[model samples]
Structure formats: C-alpha cells, structure tokens
Target: MNGVITPADTLGTRLTGLRGFYRAGYRSVLAYRADLLFGVIGFVIQTVLAVAVWRVLYDGHDEVAGVASSTAVAYAVLAGCIQSVVMPWQFSSLPQRVFRGQIGVDMMRPRSLISQNLAQAAGTMVGRLPIGVAGLAVGLALGGVQAPRSLLDLFASAVSILLGIANIMTINLLVSMIAFWTLETGGVMILYRFASAFLSGALIPLWFMPEWLQPIIGRLPFQAQIYAPLSIWFGTRHGGELIGTLALQLGWVLALFVLLQLVWRRAVHRVVVLGG
Candidate 1:
C-alpha cells in the first residue's frame, strides 16, 4: 500500500497544483474580452465624472476638502482606474463549498487550501494588472494629470499599494476560512464588502468623511486597504505618519496570518474533507 509521501513529493505536488491553478486563473478574464474592453471604457467614463466633480469643487481656489486639486485628481483617478479593475471580489463561494462539500476534494489535495486559493488570486491579479496599467496610462493621458511632487511621495504610494494588497489578501483568506466553521457566509461577505465600500475610501476620500468617525473607523484594517495607499500616492502623508501607517499594516499582516494558521488547524481537526 502507498503509506505516505516524502518532502520532495509534497513539494512537487504543491508546485504542480499551483501551476495548474495559476493557468486556470490566468485564462479567466480572457474568456470575456468584451467585458475587459467594457471595463476600460467604464474607467474612462469614471475619469470624466471625477474631473467634473473636481472642477465644481476647485472653482476659484486650487484646493478644496483640505487637499490640493492635483492630489484630489490623483486619488480620484487612481480609485477609478484601480478599484474598477483590480478591486477584490468578495466571493462567498468558499462558504458554499464548505456547506455543500464541494471543497472536500480540494481539501484532500497536498497543498494548503488557503495557500492554493491565494495562489489563484495572486495569479488572477497579475493577469488583470497589465490591463489596469494600460487603463492608468490612458487615464493620466486623457486627463493629463500628475501625481505627488517628490520621489518620496511616489515611493510611499507604491509601498502603500503593495502592503495594502498584502493586508487585503490576509484579511480575505481569513474570511474565506470562516466558511469552514459557519455556512452563513453571505451575510459575512456582505458585511465585509459594506465595510470596505464605506470605510476604505474606495468611493469617497477619507477627508470627506465625518470628522467624528475618523478615530473609530480609521483604526479598522479596511481603511489601510485603500485610503492609506492612495494618500501616499497623493503625497498626503510624510515623516512619522508614514512610518506609523506601515507599522500598522505590518501588524495586521502578521496578526491575520497567525490567526489564519490557527484557524486552519482547528478547521482541519474538526473536519478533514479528505481522509487523514
């Protein structure tokens, strides 16, 4: 009988699975070129609307809402370009698979379940990144806009985006695992999306939010996802503030990853969809 697997065998299996998943995810949006084209067109329309809004607010003065006109444009433009195309899809399929037992087979695979899914998500994001980069270029050209002034600002913005994605993945993976314990993940995903939409500065900038809510909502991990990154891109943050933001992001990443490992252990102990 086949008693067990070796380290080399396990590593090979995981790599093969990762490659397969990556290719499958890569081919996803290609199946719908029309949708991809429409997505780009939609970003263009959004760019127009944002410029119109900026004009109304910045009529006589170059600044409004406590931020410069150019910075505002960068925020709006990036939000429109990135969120419209690369924003996370809060899919509730993980929960459905758990309850319906579709994930049973997936669990039996040698690779970690969440790791496999993360690989798929990472590949999908990469697949979409080129299109998003193109849209960003088109947006900047269409509006002829410039971002923050300093090299520091550009660096801050890029760091924010990278860390923000890491944080998002950490949070989403944790949420996905929730399905293992609770089947009612629709409400969970809905709540998560609502929080992201309202708090993350995806649609509205944080400065526009009510002052009182800032202290409370600001601490939430969702804000770090969109606002902090966009702020750096706009050069709104500097010095000590930048360090604090990055620290917070690192803290959450570490915390969530730890929680995820614990959750996986408990989940598998309770129910191994694959034979142990």
Candidate 2:
C-alpha cells in the first residue's frame, strides 16, 4: 500500500509539475530586473500616448458612434494596459525551440506539452501583471480610466477577462504549434501579432472601425481577447448582450482548445532533433 500511488497522488504530482513550470516562467521574467523596469516604463509611456491619441481624435466631439469621448479615452488606456499584460508580441517560444531542435527535450518530459506551455504562458502573464497595474494607475491619475458603471458590470467584466485570457492563450498556443510543420515562424509570428493587434481591438476599438467591418470583427475570436471584456467594463455590453459575448468567448476557448489538441497530435510526430 505504501509503494502504490493513488489517483489523488497522481493528480497532485501532475499539478506540482505544472506549478514548477509556472514558477520557472515567472522567475525567468523577473531575472532581469532592468528589463522589468524598462518594460514598465515603456508600457506607461505607451498607455499615455494611446490615451492622448484617442483624446485628439475626439477633440471636437462629445461622442462618436454613441460612445462618449471620455469612454473612448478610458478604453484606450485600459486597452493598452490589457494589451501589455496579454503581451501578444512574443506569442510563444515554441517555434524558436523547434527550429533549434530543442523541442525534443520538451516532448520527452512526463507532462503534456500543451499544458506545460499554457502554464508557462500564464506565469509570464502574471509576471507582467505589475506593468499593467502601473499603467492603470497612470490612467487613473490622468482621469482616463473610470470606475465600472455598476457592481454587476465589474463582476461581469472580471469573468469576461478570465475567459478572454483563456481565449488568447489557446489561440496563441495554436499559432505556436505551427512550428511542427514550418520549423521556423519568425515572419508568421510577426504577421500574427500585427493582425491580432488590430483585430483584437487593442489598436483601434470596434466602435471607431468602419460600419461594415464592425460586425465582421465581432465574430472573430480576437474580439473576445480584448474588446469584449473592455466593452463590458465600459458598460457598452450588458443584459442579454453581455451573456452572449461571454458565451462567445467560452465557445472560442473551447473550440480553440479542441483545435490545439488536433494540431498537437500531429505536431508531436513531426518533432525534429538536431541529429540522427
């Protein structure tokens, strides 16, 4: 009985392994203190600049597309901070490791590769949380970020944010898994980041986009990543509309996770080592 492991033990072991990956990922970000400092400074500057740009756009108008100028400014500030924390720029290190023949080591680990990667990504996001918080503080000081319209709005936004984070991590994981076939994804990763920024509404809100394009973007998973939660926070989405948006986010997260599994199965077989 002592030598035999129980199901609960097995589960605990697996969770412990995942936590190791999370801590490693988190510490890696904090290892370079200078980078952390500069990163926060850069993000603060970016948030402020984005806020200023939105203000300029709304210079002579009280509202555009039924969204008040103040709302737009707050959206920009929060969007920038959210984008900073989401950190879509790097996407994942999978493609690079694959190209370098290091993925074989990852595959050899006892845990599932996808779970490990997601845990690491979550760690990295947590590590960068301070930067987002600092940017929000700046926004608050500048009067660019306002309180939620109501407590319900706050609660709904919080749930949507979690879903949005899952949607983002899953989508990015799918992108990273592309390395199994391509072996190198520098150009593709860059392109994906650019497209995500626009489509996710981090660069420009859907309200400001062309009339015909708004609904189309709304249907995409990218919108669920940043726009949906922020819109909920802004009180633009509520009632049945809020429920629908959250449902869509959950749907995309589930669908993307399924797609990730399919891709991962093929990806594992395609791993390339440095030598025979």
Best by TM-score: 2
C-alpha lDDT of candidate 2 relative to the true structure: 0.87
Candidate 1 Cα outliers beyond 4 Å, as residue runs? 1-17, 90-93, 181-184, 269-276
| Candidate 1 Cα RMSD (Å) | 4.3
Which of the numbered candidates is closest to the native, going by highest lDDT?
2
lDDT (Cα, tens digit) per residue for candidate 2, span 4-111 = 999999999999989988987788779987988999999889888977888998899998889998998998888888888876467677777777877778888999
Candidate 2 lDDT for residue 144 = 92
Error of 1 at 211 (Å): 2.1
Can you write out model 1's per-residue Cα lDDT over 90-167, one digit (the tens) per residue?
A: 432456567778787878787778777777666666666655676578767766367667888888778888887877
- TM-score of each candidate? 0.83, 0.94
